[model samples]
Target: MKRIARVILLLLLVAGLWLALKPTLGNRRLTFLPQHWSEYLDYMDFWLNLGAFAILGLTVWFALGALEKVLQRLCLMIGSITLMNLFLEAMQSSIPGRAMDRADIWAGLLGCILGIATGLAFQLFAVRKKSRTTSPQVLFLDQTGRLGGAELMLLDIAAARAADSEVALFQDGEFRTALENAHVKTHVFKLGEEASAVDKQAGVASALASIPAILDLVLQIARAARAFDVVYANTAKSLIIGGPAARLAGRRLIFHLHDIIADGHFSSLNQKALIFCANYCARKVIANSEATKAAFIASGGRADLCVVVPNGFQIPEERTSTAKTSALRSSLGIQPAAWTVLMAGRLSHWKGQHVLLEALKSVPTAHAILLGDALFTDEDRLYAQRLHTQAEEPELKGRIHFAGFQSDTMPYFDMADAVVHASVFPEPFGRVIVEGMLAGKPVIASRAGGAAEIIQHEQTGLLVDPGNADELAAALLRLQTDTAFSSTLARQARQAAQDTYALDAVQEKIESVIRHIAGSNKSQLLSPAIPLPKPPPCAA
Candidate 1:
């Protein structure tokens, strides 16, 4: 109901903004006179307008108990007004017979500023006049210092300042800067300057090394847990370490799963370890996608504890430049005649870069640009070296190029006619495929994981059988040869991407889940662990 109200309010705001600014927009630029401003101002109008919204906003705020919950109350107020202003900006774009004016946008900005100021003014006045308390906060954990997907989501959460949220990460990673930029308080776990002796050890040695430090870290986190309403574990290591501590502290723990384990990308032991940790420690598990949630349940996880939350994205401006694409191709040493097939991700076997190579052998692409660098485990570094060697093999030489890791893959995506995600194993979520779609490029992905759920073969994008070189090759060939069919697919893919992965839609779903959990009294809301119903042993 609250979510619906919020959406309705935003829609009204958009409508109001459209009404107010309709006189200001067109293909032609125009200026307005400020001298007549006083003529338009009426004393009664000021009182009536301010009073109307103030009353409405306060009613909502008070009903939502914002008076008692400081941060959340502030979030509600800010989010409401921010959406209002954003809608107003959007309204500045002409709507048929509607009038559009830049002045109205300026007015909307003024209104937002006044609203926020009014809110702060009221808060300050109330505090000065009386005493008030704030609710406990939720600590959002992100151990990965880099501003990757986990960090990006954490940044958005921080920006929302939703439900007394705060962020914590490793001391050295780039996430601290991102959090700081978002005006989110940053707390470092400070697990020393480097991974402890135990963290550096692999297999048994590494497991032993991580145990004590992790346990100690858990205790420390448990102590700090007093300040938070809940401790959210955003990374695998944190889930393993922080879950027990949160439980010990009698606090709720949320373990967010961003990756799928049984995807054979991780070693057998690594997969088992992740499941074991999740099963034993997490009070609740938040899977980034329904596919991940299903995978977890299949591996003896508690279904009741699992919550499906798909990934979100902010659509980037479409960049068009034939010259830029040509430049990118030139820099990569590709001939204009060669068709450049692209695959992007952190270079890893689990990511299925090798699958792309195996498929490449069956296809007749002019060249392929493999983008990304070794990340997380070094298990795939040697595999990458071997892939390079394979690329140099008699038939494949000069046909495959290692482009290394690129922060901005837009140029690469633009250079390629189609983007491929040939993951032999299921991906927890295939962000690249969506990104490719958003870039208005057709995609071919493995029929597993999130890709299976998002792509409709021949409609939005192509899906090939996982680990099947022949199918992937055929899909690639069809895309390369059939421009009309490919364009249709790209168009549909873009629409689907916009509809499903757009920031606002994705954020709405995420916020709804967070609001639901925050409203609950239990620190941990475990999903029921139900056994998977058997399918009659494959009818053998």
Candidate 2:
């Protein structure tokens, strides 16, 4: 179907271009040239040229298909069409009865702009039609609008499902902007205003205070849930609020477990409450890693209701030139010969930005770049300040650089010799570990939680004890000194990442789970569990 459409568009473009330029081509000679813009406007030939260019522009726009960026699409359409029309008009000046005029160029530009607008409108209408006819309607509920690891993962999932899904954010923040940029339909529940302000440290008291607000938000979600086939809860807070709402609306609920809901990260009471919600309300539980699923089950979540689905990433196209990498290093004042190690995540203590800093002291020749900032909580802010103070210490000065939060970290990944994951606590899923692997960088990750699941020790990548600076430092030195060993690991890791964590494969698995629950009868929703697939050999 797509090939046919492209062929038709190509034919139209060819015909339009021929008709628009015919007057200035072949045996035509220069005569009766229009000296003024008014003279060009009076000629009926001007409108024919303008209409031909408009058709040409519209055909070009349709041929481009659905581009991820609207601005880039518009620029390509308008700029290319306008330049082509202007060049053709200039050519017309040398031909008889084919006079060049500024008015003709302006008319063509206006027509191209109108054509682009028309193409965009048609594209939107087609999207709506496809959503209604082919795809399942999904309502995604997320707790915070902050762009944390889970939120970033959610954005990827939402982007994959955007053709038929609507995302509801509990509170407004940067994640909302990201969703909008991805062209995903998003809604912010204003009732979550008070709930969003509550501090993470407030514990049980915070939960108690947010109940009324949560209930109000639940009512809003329940009403919205009626229109969707699946209610996907992307966070613990969302599962708590949206699970009941999904139940109220008689819709299938899928809980996306992104964290280790254990006593370390959550209080005992909170852990129990989370388990209760998952076991009782949610029809299916999608754990980001096997480790997360194990933790959830250990905390009394129903094993039958859970399935492990690791996060996936798209391997970015490799840079053909080293110019951009060199520019990035120079801008950061990093020595060209220095061994650069990168650690990317929010600058929270548990994320272990300080731990990475401490390890850098042992590897004096290596420079470290921390690629994220404190995005949520007062504790995270203080933690970031402490990391800065620690980095300023005599031993660490000039060796460690804080690059802060970057929306695009791929360039930094390319600049690094090795990527490190130094989380003090067990991470639910270390996205950076796989990302570095995909970039073909030797990843030295913590030998705990999901990081362990990603790296196959010395075979694929190196793993060290969590929070142990000495072990991390030793691993870094080993990679720097042992050139052949590091290259082998990086090569294997890259291949493993491509085989297991490609976005298309993972999204299909997730979509299947959603469709299964959505299609199941109400009585069978919780009774028959989707059997957990065996973990990948590298993960095992």
Candidate 3:
């Protein structure tokens, strides 16, 4: 479709050039379409030129297709087209009987605007068509193909509903392949690198630029969403586009919020937009933790729109034997007597790998194994390098192990004396904390946000002030020396995991939310969600 649009745009540009630069037959100045009411009105020629320019605008706008990567390509395409039109007008001055006209420029610009509006109206109309498929109860939307925490969770959700659901992703990666491996019907609709690159730091201009691509993807998803009873967005980006698509398709929208919508994590513009979409569009907002829910409420998000749902985790009935865990410990070459601290997560600044390295300096007897790697970007890779430099220091030499990213973290977890989550920021939901507990190890997580919600100080696990290496060091020492206490904490933590974050209960709760809203009528056009709009007065 985009290829064909580009061809039409090229031909329109050629026709525009001919109209502006073609010599007049009489060799006198040609003013076929008079702009003023005073001059003899050439209504026929006037309408003809206006129609031509309007078609030009439509083709240009369509050629730009979703204006992906507004920062670079969007600016380039628009600037190039503007320069082309201006150059053609300039060339008309060189013609024997023609001259560049400012009135023409103004008319062309207006035509372009009208063309873009028409294209948008068409897309909006396309969404109003109701879905006919009713067998698939849900449609899951995710923006990235990478297996982040959210993708991992979605894998479980989609897999459970593989018989009656489909996953639509914006990019292609292991996440898609994994879904296919799990027998979950998956489709990839590439949203281009330009659109995906617009991150939380992106300003209003960048977002405005990405709208073309956002809308394009939304239209595609909305069309597909018509077949399903519900639309589920697993990431913030997905929610931004999916929310509108679901509403347009007359389907119930559910936003599975994985990030805490805050200035610290997202730009102010993003925070407002997310809260707006959730409040006005979605039937339910499934927050991973109460901390996530609190942050949502604090950020102008409606309090009643959110429902806290912890990511479900379950311990295996047949646990790895002690011998296997000991073997993993021996492979790392640290002495068996050395206290081991295990932290598993992507190696990023906020994930606190650096702080954990600093804390190790205060606990001389401890050895640390850092699992997970910088999954994306050069910044994280540099962070990993700095960590290596920290490990090479005399006091920390031969103690810190960089295990990198592991497909399976169970053996590493089994070998650990304690699992530490040292994120500098408040985590939305500490997957590592529950993971450690499921592995039957004591957990010490930063005491804020969702991590704080998971651990009771000195009970199931310990919590320290975020980013404080000294406090973290103290917690490590306490866990290392107090074997009996650590064992108790691990046992209590395991119980806590089984009761609250058990996989069965977590999936069941989420499925229940889906079941409740899946029956909503899909024939009706878009309408404002509850709490955002007051209910109509009841008939007595």
Q: Which candidate gets the maximum lDDT versus the true structure?
A: 2
Please, what are the lDDT tens digits per residue for candidate 3 over residues 1-540?
A: 668989988887776666667677543224454345313333344455556666876676567734122234334544565576678778888978677777666666666556655764564455443233334378999988888889889998899889889999998988999999999999999897668878766788889888899889989998999778789999998999899998778678889999987767888888777887888778889999999998888887777778988998756877778888788888888777778999999988889999999999999989999999887657788988988998999999999998877767788898888999999889999998999998889999999889998998888999999999999999999998888999999999998888888888889989888876664442232222322374222111
Query: Per-prediction RMSD in angstroms?
Result: 21.6, 20.5, 13.6
lDDT of 2 by residue, 1-540 (tens): 447657877787676566446553233222244445434534565686577666766666777744234666687779987887788778867756566788778878888887777876787676556545776789998878778888888899899879889999888888899999999999998755557765434467777888898888888999999778789999988888898898778677999999997755776656767787788788799999999999988877778889999997876776424788888888888999999999999888888888888888888899999999998777889999998899899998998888988887889998899999998889999999998999889999989899999999999999899899999889999999999999999999999999999988999999999878866633243333344343221110
Residues forming the 10-long window of minimal summed lDDT in candidate 1: 531-540
- Per-residue alpha-carbon lDDT of candidate 1 for residues 118-198, written as tens digits (9 for 90 to 100): 654565566434322443367877666765666666677567664477776654566687677777787888665334322
Q: Please give the clash total of every predicted structure, in order.
A: 14, 5, 3
Candidate 3 regions off by >4 Å? 1-136, 522-540
Q: Give the TM-score of candidate 3.
A: 0.72
Q: Against the hidden reference, what TM-scores do the models get?
A: 0.67, 0.72, 0.72
Positional deviation of 534 in candidate 1, in angstroms? Answer: 25
lDDT of each model, Cα atoms only?
0.68, 0.81, 0.81
| Candidate 3 global lDDT | 0.81
